[model samples]
Structures are given as structure tokens and as C-alpha cells.
Target: MAKSDSVTRSAVLHRDTRFVPKKAVGGKGSYIFLEDGTKFLDSTGGAAVSCLGHGHEEVSQAVINQINQISYCHTAFFGTEASEELARLLTESTGGKLSKLFVVSSGSEAVEAALKLARQYFLELPTPQPQRTRFIARKPSYHGVTLGALSVGGHMIRRQPFEPLLSSNTSHVSPCYPYRGKKAGESDADYVNRLAEELDGEFQRVGPDNVCAFIAEPVVGAALGAVAAVPGYFPAMKAICEKYGALFILDEVMSGMGRCGTLHVWEQEGIVPDLQTIGKGLGGGYAPVSGLLIGEKVVEVMDRGTGVFRHGQTYQGHPVACAAALAVQKIIQRDNLLENVRKMGAYLEERLRGCLGDHPNVGDIRGRGLFWGIEFVKDRESKEPFSPETGVAFQVQETGLDPSHGISLYASNGTVDCTKGDHVLLAPPYNVTKEEIDIIVDTAGRVIEAVFAKVNAA
Candidate 1:
């Protein structure tokens, strides 16, 4: 057995059965330090969670203050000040339409609450359609890992093992992936319309009246590597949901909170969801926090139908998490960080193009704001992905973490249709400097080239 494996086997059940991660001893700004004092630039923000990066004195101070006041409180009995203030700020920014905020400890919990709230909204309908039990989602999408979130997620590999336990009421259609899915002769408009048609067909097949909600990531995260939908896709989707009287749930857990250069990605797409799940950068990784932002349309239905939304968690609206998130958000707004995201995002894109635009194995480079993805293909013309068994992306990631490079990233295999391609994801903190951005892209380019060369030689 490997040393890491032996160590983990004696202590815990880690995600990878064969490997154990090194202990993270400390962190500052946009880098994390390992036990051996080797530091890695946190390019992926620990899966796009650390927006403010690590070691923010302000966020840390806020958490400390909240804990001193009251860390835990039974939401069943009394709501805390921090939770109230955070909800007020969120609702205010959302223009009051997103009035109710249901806080949770993690993205999955928020998603679970969102799903239950959706189901409960239907229950409150005076003459609710009994057949409204199905859900419409898109493939190459990820919501979360809990049962409810997993039910809505369309990631084939993640859902495969739990297929038996997952709800059969869910249906997945093609994502609005323009790079690979769009035909050579088709225009962007036509490609979008085709995807809309596919979604419509799925809804019809599932029986429009039976579909409760259509859940999607405004910009697909994790699964497709920051794959934003084709222009006009979301408007078309929202219209369809409206026509069918179905709710729309946008899972912005990874793409929202300024990661996509906006407070909410749907704002950029010119659409609003009936319910939204947000996390990751919500608390800037200072504390565990996630939330369900309910739209006025859904609120109205619930208000008219039933007086109460039936769902609650013990740790819902924890004071310390709220305080930390509140402080983090205030800093974002107070500092006008969105403007920086727009400026830095363009710079990052240009640097990436300059560095890796013509690499032989690089298939596509795409993303928005600070989130970016580099896909690799064996045959560029055919966009043929490397075999999954090769694990090319994982190797590149491991090489990037070498002491000489000292860059960390989000990497994955099976990007092509969830079982064939490799991709390296970069989601540096929003507060990252131009120099840091250059270092991240340059290091990533070098590491990717090295891995590609090795693979080709083999």
C-alpha cells in the first residue's frame, strides 16, 4: 500500500480509496501551505469556493465576533442577527423579489431545501396537478451530491453508482454546448433553438403537466468546466418553463457570487429563476454557508397555496456562517470587486490565449469572469478526447502541483459526454492580482505542455 493510503486507512474514509491528500497547514491570500511548507497557488479556489481567497482578516474577525455573541441557535425558535442582516442584504440586492432566504451549511443542503421547497410549492397549489412529479435538467450538469441535488444533477459518472437510489422522475436533455455539440453549418441561433427544441421535446415526453421544475446551471460548472449556455438559451428555457407553469431553478452554487463577474449569473443571461441555490464564494471559504433564494413568483404561489413552506434543518441559518458571509459580501460590494472581475477576466483570457492557443492537444479554452477551463483532445480536428483510462488530466494536475511549479488547479477526466475527455479548470480568487493571474496561466500552460509531451511520447 502507498504511504498516503496506509495513513488514511488507519484514520478515515477519504474520497479516493488509493490516495490521501496532504494536510493543509496554513493559507494566505490566494495560496495554501502544506505541512512541508511548500505553498501552492490556489487556482481553483478549492472548487471555486474561495472568492476572497484565504486568510482574510476581516472575515475571520467577523466569525470571531459572531461566535462570541452566539454561534449556534435553534432556527426553530429564534433567528440570529447575522442571519437576518445577511438575508436583508441579499434580498435588497435582488430587488426584493428574492425575499425569502433559507440558509444551510453546505451547497447540497441548500439544494435539498430548494427541491423540497419546489415540491412544497406544488403541494400548496389549491388544485395542484397530481401528475406534477417529474423534473427536467440538462446533461453535463452538476448541482450537488445529496440525494435531492443528485437527483437533479445529470453527471453520469457521479450518478451511475447511485442510479438505483435516484429518483426516476428526473430527465436530462442536451446542454447548450456550442463548441462540440453545434454543427459546422449551423449558426449560433440555430444551435440554441435546437437545444431549446430538445428541452421542449423532453418536457413533452415527460408530460409538461407532470414536470415540477426545470433545474439548470446558468453556467455549467464542475461537470462541463465552466461551460456557459449558448446565448438566448436561458431566455428560451425560462419561456418554456413559464408556458408549462413549471418552476425554474438555477443552481449557481459555483458560478454565482461574483465568480462569473456578476452577483448572479442569471442576471447576465437576462433571466430570473423561481429558485436559486448559491454557495462556494458565498462565504469566501471562511465558513460553511449556502442558501436558497426564492423568487417572488414562487413565493406568491406558496403564499396563495399554503401558509408555510415545509422544510427545516438543524444548522439552518447558523449565526457564525452568516456573519462570515455577510462580512465577505460587504467587502465585495464595498470594494467594487465585480468591476475588477470584468477587467481581470479579460486580462486572464488574453494571457491564456497567448500561452496555450496553439498547443497541439488543446481542444478548447472557454469560460467567463475568473472561471476558465482548458479541454484536451487527442485529435484536434475531430475533437477526439483521450481515453478515460489514460487519466491525462489527473497527471497534468499532479505535475502542476510539483514544487518547481507550485500551482494548484481543478482537474478532471471524462469531460466528453461524461466519460472520455480531460479538462483542467482554473478559478483563481476574484481578488487575484494581474501578476498572480499571469503566474497561474503561465504555470498551467507549462504543466499542460509537459503532460501533453509525455503522453504523446508514450
Candidate 2:
């Protein structure tokens, strides 16, 4: 169906006001069809949410059946079976390490809940320390958009306008970014220890007794383009948090739920967070859902207290959302999709490197599992990023979206700071085929080449 000129003038507020985006009429498997009949291979899974892909029959049926049974039920009054089952599945997947779940409607909400829980956990202690109010987070990290989550998030561009409203209780340390943070002669061990020391110094500067938690993304997502830490990075950071009596919080909204081949990204890191937040692939884009996974320690504190979380949202545990997520998880287990993620993830890394490893402008290609990122620089040897005025990543994304290219990639900036770097992320569905992977890499190669060619011409 072709969209009329009138329809192009959408009533809904879009991300960009300068140009209206093409309307997507439908989607199936790994492709989204536009109103103009253009088909795009969804390489980034719409910001890595569509893990199971579009039009999954089982997930759709689960949502419909849930709506028919009971769509909405306030948690204050009662709990639904869908929420209970989903929570049980999630907790069991963690081997009871994260013993409880607080389902929410979005990743931001999950982060918000985790932050509140951290504060409340301290207050509930036998000798409550009201001074434990500060939070330490890493720079170039993204937690969420909600005020509290945004406060802890280190994305300066997103935080600048809202700085006045953000809490001053939060402080940021340098991220574990090897591409930029590591010195030329430094060993991985040395780099990790240096970062750990920085975090420890922040705790001291802020008065360790005044801090509640130290939060970070196990694998930095869009903000840093899937940058994972060095071998001992997480364990060292967790040790610092432990030393300071601060809870360790991991925001896996983009990296968890089998997106990185494991049920939880932290599983591969060898550390269990005191509070963990998961979203994106949880419902496989079938519904809006995210969750806060509470560890045994936090649960013990709550149990010893009033046994009630002070936060509540009307859709805190919507039946339809929980049902959709449960179905998505079940399919992942039944189909052994995580195994596919590992196999295909290795293939993707190999293909990306083989395709553009030596491109003069392609500075780095880093990722694990099915998630990957390609950073573009003006000079590869120096790792000098293209000027922000160039908008290299956004140009690549737009070029990929062109009907001729027919690909959709995720674009991000500020990998060097809050304003300097440009990178594109590719996160195809977990069940993507080898052939599709080939097409993704090939198309991405062409898109990047074409965009940079234009840049050179300009």
C-alpha cells in the first residue's frame, strides 16, 4: 500500500522533525516492508530488540490468548499467572543467583527500579546508613532515559539538556574502553587494574560510606557500540564495589536475554550483580517488557523489612507483556536459539573482519555473540574520529535505508566522548541464517563504502 502525501504528514511526534520517515507497512522474519513496497533487511533488529524477528506465530498467539484470558490486572490487587511464570523462568535461568524479579514495562523502568531498590536496601539494613546515597557509574555508558537512570548514565549529549534536573549524587569514572582508554604499551592486566583503581578512587573521593551502588553495562551498548571490558575488568570492578560496601549493578538491557549467546552477559564475565536489569530481547519485540532481577542479598534485606517495594506502575506486570516475554523465552529454549547465536555470532565477526577489516576509515570492528559494531575514523592509524559535523554514522544509516540499498543499520555517535566518534551496530536476529548474514555484511560494506565515497567527494 502506498502512503498518501497527507499520511506523510504524521500526527505522531517523530525522532526527527526535519524529515518524515517512510512508513513501515509490515514485517516478517528479518525484513520490514515499507509503505512504498521497499523491503529492508533489519540488520540491527530495530536497536537489537527483535531477537525472534517479526511475525512470530507462537509469540503472537501467546499475546492474543493472554488478552482473551485477562489483559490487565493491577499488581497491587493481585498477581497474574503470566507474570509469575515469566519471573520463575527468568530467576531459574540465573540459577537462583538473582532470586527475584520485578517486571516493568521498559528498560528505563527496570533501571529506575534497580536504583530505588539499591537505596531502599541500604535503608532496610539493621543499622541503616542514610548517608549511603551516592552512585558511581562509568562514562560513555547508557542505562536508560528516565531521570534516575539518566542521572547514572554517562552519555553527556543526552544528559546535557537535562543536567539541571539530574541528581548530583551520581559521579562517572572512565569506561573500560580498550580502543581509546588503553595505552600503547599497557598490558590488558595493567589497563584493567588502572580502571579498577579509578573506580576505587571515585569511591574514596565521594566518601565510600556515602555511596549506595556502582553501576555499569557488562557490554557497553549503543553509547559505546558493544565495547566489552578486558578479561579481569568486571571482577576487578565488582571487587572495588565490594570493598566500598556498595552494591554492584549491571544494566544488560541491550546485552542480556541471550543477545550475547548466554542467557545473561554477566554469566560470561564471571560476576553476579547485586541488581541486574534486562530488556530489549526479553519480549523479542512482540511486546513491551523489561525486568529487574534482584539478588539473594537484596531479597534478604527486603524480606527482613516490610517485604514491599515502594515502587509501582499501573502496567508493572501486564499479563499480555509477560505472556509475550514468556513465549519468546520458551521458543529460545525449545529451538536452542542461543546455540545458533554463538555459531552465527562467530560467523558474523569473521565476515565483518574479512569484508572491511582493512578499510582505511574503518577503525575498529568489535563485538561478541550476535552483536557487533563498526567504528569509522578519519585516520585509522591515529584512531582519529571524523568530525561530528560529518555525521558519518547517520549518513551510513540513511544510505543503508535507501531503497537501492534496502538495509537498516543502527547508527550511534560519541564513542570518543559525548560528541566525537561515529559507529554503526549490526544485531540481526538470533535465528538469522548464514545466507542472511552474508547479505548483511555485503550490504553493510556497500553502504559504508558509498557513504564514505560521498564524504570524500564532498
Task: Please tell me which predicted candidate would have the highest lDDT against the true structure.
Answer: 2
- Tens digits of per-residue lDDT for model 2 on 288-313? 99999999999999899889898889
Model 2 / residue 403 / CA error / Å: 0.4
Q: What are the clashing pairs of model 2?
A: none
Clashes of each: 0, 0
Residue by residue across 1-458, what tens digits does model 1's lDDT show? 11243553546676666677777889999999987677878988988999989999999999999999998989889988899999999988888878888899898998888888888788777787667888888887888889878988888898999989998888999888888889989988898888888888888898898888999988777888878888888999999999898989999999998999999998899887899999998998899999999998778878787667788788889999999999999999999998888889999999988898898898898999999988889988999999998888888888887877878768876677889888888888888899999889888988988888899999
Q: What TM value does model 2 have?
A: 0.98
Off by over 4 Å in 2: 1-8
- Minimal lDDT window, size 10, model 1: 1-10
lDDT of each: 0.87, 0.92
lDDT for 392 (candidate 1): 86
lDDT of 2: 0.92
